[model samples]
Target chain A: MSAAPAPRYLARPLAAIGRPVLAGLASVGRMAIFTLTVISHLIRPPFYPREFAHAIMTIGWYSLPVVGLTALFTGGALALQIYDGSSRFSAEAAVPSIVAIGMARELGPVLGGLMVAARVASSIAAEIGTMKVTEQIDALVTLSTNPIKYLAVPRVLAATLTVPVLVAVGDSIGIMGGWLVGVNRLDFNSAAYLKNTIDFLEAADVASGIAKGAVFGFIIAMMGCFYGMSSGRGAQGVGKATKLAVVASSVLILGSNYLLTEVFFSG
Target chain B: MIELQDVHKAFGDKRVLCGVTLTVPKGESMVIIGGSGTGKSVTLKCILGLVTPDAGTITVGGQPVTKGDRDAFLARFGMLFQGAALFDSLTVWQNVAFRLLRGAQKRARAEAREIAIEKLRRVGLKAETADLYPAELSGGMQKRVGLARAIAADPEIIFFDEPTTGLDPIMAGVINDLIREIVVEMGATAITITHDMTSVRAIADDVAMLHDGVIQWTGTVAEMDGCGDPYVEQFINGRADGPIEAVR
Candidate 1:
């Protein structure tokens, strides 16, 4: 009897733990299928040029102010921190190159992507989630429109194309921001600071950041569309989807940044 | 014609539709009446292929719903959702002309706008209302825009899910009249899901009562009162005491 009870107790706890693990795995599978569907739709569409144009405006142009501001402040702060840290060893001259390389290789793309994720991911999820809740997506279906083609493909394509450009612009502004702070506050010569930054930033560094930006952009839009399209029901359901979109895209951005860095520079 | 034979659907452990079988003849206005959560919406969704059934066969015009070019099949139908479900980003006319402006039914910009405006007028909206976004309109106006959109494509089959829901009695009456007039005028088969008796009386030539996952009764509206089905009587009378558990 004691042995039988022990099996029962063990079974109950195991099932409880297994349930969530299974659920998480199922969600991952669903997201994989969703990603494949989006990619397939991208190539097979009676493409919506209008929707693509609108998405480009919404995801790229509208995100600029926030991306710019985040990069500016971050670059300035990085310069200050680098200057203070290196002065201890009389290595103050290393600040400009380090800041340039850091911004071009890491901070610019990551922060820019994060800012866009906070802005675009939440909005995309909310809009599409509300559409799902309201049955507009079904309405599209009834009207002989494929929701994935009409909605997800345009947004995903626009994001993939535009985010790299945003990263490039962000890298330039960031380097300028570091220069501004270094010359004004740290008493570095403006021309010397600019020369050092230019010398330190290799084409590969900038290219790698831009490449990461494209992947991060895809993650942001994919998470938003996937959550939105699969959202449960009602206001609470849409809210949950929006929250998940932001959280998932942000996490994926950071996680992929690590992997991409390994691929691009681990040699 | 639309037919569902032994349809079954369950979400998780909650069985929503169980062995529901019904038939809707062509050019007939069939209104499905049921209590809240009785699978009325799910039934419509199943017919539209928006929600797949766990087990069943559904056919339209003797063609299986699942077989054929999905786009061509969907082009035959239009649906008005309970919440209007107008695209928030588009203007009222743009919403109405959505189908016409794209795909196989593509029309010139001016031509599509003209058709959208004409449909808007038919639904009792002014031409000026066409340019305004859905959010800029009142609930009643939004519903009219939705109605206009439903008929814009002139689909052979149309479905209205709670067409008169959330409107004032006067507005409800107006919408019912509009729906009836539109169905008759277009010679389109219609399936409406509603619990509103007034709408059933106005819009249905025949009525089907859904209860306990299956259609409990179905007959002409004229025969509905004398149908003698306990579920139909309980539902028609809106009574709490009956075979159906009111709490559910």
Candidate 2:
């Protein structure tokens, strides 16, 4: 083939590389437009209160048990690990303070968000994706209802408002978990451990974690809806959207968690 | 009255509608026929504003279809989707009264339910059927519920998309007859997109054949038989060897 000519050969590889990059950029642009549409509809008239209430009950109330379980186990494990590590330098007494700070500042919001993403995001994506495939979304439009307002905004608003509350509950339950482990397993003085946890955790520490939760909740519900509206083809398309909803929401929660931490404590 | 002038649309590289133009005068039922994927449904969607046209204007009642008061605009029109797109989450009555439950068409909950029951009765559904979800109904029952919802608000304009695509011949004939009676009784402007000649003869005052993204023929149903347009002739006769491919 005469080596395929040097310039043409280089052009083929370059075009191949540019193709995926272009597609990715286009995907991002589409998502940005969808996000803006959702936000605009959020403030407009004809808001659906029934739908919003239903979403709050689904995303917030139904999600509490799993969140509680995850917080409890994580808190206990965290206390044990902190006690073991801090003992090397005769610093075992620091377990209560560290566990309180850790649960309140990071683990509470991040883990609760990821758990909700795993549970709720996938469900929202699957439900909406199936609706798209079955043409119910189109039916809603033809019936003089805006799908963004009826479907997306309600779920997103519910998540944003409820997740911070969930994070607060998770934080309390988590601290209790640490207290139980510290008193029963770690042999720490009971009153002293409680006093240290309470003293080390400032108002800002709890506020910062709950605030992170609100951001994570927004990302979780938005990704579910974003992928759902953008779903394609058929059963396989819905399946892919469900998977991406969970994966994207989890990654976004962790990434935004780090960014929010930097902002809240960088000083 | 409704009119489309030089409407154009495309999905990526596939140009689904290229310069489609047509008009339906007040109280007339216009049927658009074309082979699969030749943009028949896209034409209906363009009029409904579900799919935006890349070019040209659509007007309803001598006003541009895209402008002001969308709720008021859509409230004047009703559409029966090809797949009977009822909300599975709701019972039959809820789906029928969906429009009445909110917006400018809002009604008291009890009144809306009563109207839903009345519409269901008109479509031959029993009041007891109103409490059943769409999934619990047979396909024909579901289609009737969809039809009930379409006419629940007593729209000034009604569009039926593939009204008999997936029904047995007897059920299809029943649906076609009901559609004919309903359209005549209401005197509503109707546009139906379907390739079924039986439905055409049963529903159309005027017929338009779409081919290759444009109107291939336009005339009354009486003229469709003698217009000598090969595309219309081939399509109506279901010929495999002529213009519309047996396999596009």
Candidate 3:
């Protein structure tokens, strides 16, 4: 027997729900295609060495201070929280191990990635969006230059290579922050805290964080370029693209962090 | 010759171009005149292959614009955008010499700079203006720089999209005269899209009136005034009441 149709009142709610779902899925498909295009361009020839060098400096060297500061503060706060919790069970001595593991496996890469996304993604989107609006991108095309090769590839490659180094440095700074809190506030011996952190942190934990960082970097650059290139006209269009790039990159960073953690530790 | 045969394009529900057919013979200056949002620019872009048409075809020198080597085809043409659209980061000379600094037209740095300076001088910009960025220059200077950049490679075809839009009367006159002189001197085929009647008279060898996504009239500048076509007469005379609607 044939099924009866839904009631008239249900149609409005169902249509409202289905509309956004369809838009969201379509957006995801577009982003996937954009990512593949970027990958295809990455392996092609006619590389721009000068543009590449400039991107490395912009993405890597310039992002160092903010990443380091975020890691330091997060580590210090983690140490304090761990000490307070552990002391309830007379396990205050466990602060060093817990802080070390937390900073190395989670806080360092996630916080550092978020900071870079805030700084880099917004700027890339604004710059490229403005270019698109002003027709400089079309100008580049009329000059017989490929916009993807000239603009997207170098920036994406630079971000992918640099964020891991940022994460590694952030991990070290975070550990140092935890050490300082452990020694001065918790009344733990410096030598004992250092030994505990060193012993408890596994190589795989730090490696996994760095790997997460690389993925985050790729996401940041891709979101920036995709939104920028597809931005609408005028100042409002540029502003919207910039906002979307940062928001999307940040959410993706957090979501991917969870998935990466699950993959690395689920077994 | 460049030819567009029944080219059509649409964005969502709004149809921009519907069966636009026209031609510019070799080494002739063809100015397309139409009201705002009438697809004058789209027709130019279709010929340049910047915007793809949903139907019909465009060709340059009897070869389809969509086929063969894109770079080789583009190398034959240069364009001055309505906003000048200079690269904000590059200095005047660098912006002018951008095409020369890379790709197949790559030249020695000194040579490219020399050519850039010469083009700047040709556009009536002084040597001192070369080092200044686009933001540092006045609107007229920026337009001149854009014109210089378009001619830097000595392209065989050149396009001017609203070349005098933002300039004062004197500056507008200067730009119109410069475009005419350069097109003649270089023997370049020219396709300009402008509604500026003064510019039309100054630069056009032949004029085509585009309205409602089709050519309403076509003739030489001398014939434009007495063409007797309602759309062309209404547009050239700037009458608020006519066959064309005032409000888009």
TM-score for all models, in order of appearance: 0.97, 0.94, 0.95
Name the weakest run of 10 consecutive residues (lDDT summed) in model 3 chain B. B41-50
lDDT of 1 by residue, A195-244 (tens): 88888779999999999999999999999999999898999999999999
Cα lDDT of model 2 by residue, A171-230, tens digit: 989988988999999888899999999888899999999999999989989999999988
- Summing lDDT over every window of 10 consecutive residues in candidate 1 chain B, give the lowest-scoring window: B71-80
Error of 1 at A95 (Å): 1.9
Off by over 4 Å in 1: A1-6
Model 2 per-residue lDDT at B126: 95
User: Which scores higher on TM-score, 2 or 3?
Assistant: 3
Candidate 2, TM-score vs. the true structure?
0.94
Worst 10 residues of 1 chain A by lDDT: A1-10
lDDT of 3 by residue, A1-267 (tens): 999999989998999999999999998999999889889999888788888898899999999999999988888899999999988999988898888888878999899999999999998999899999999998899888899899999999999999999999999999999889888888899999999988988999899989998999999988899889988899999999999999999999999999999999998
lDDT of 3 at A37: 89
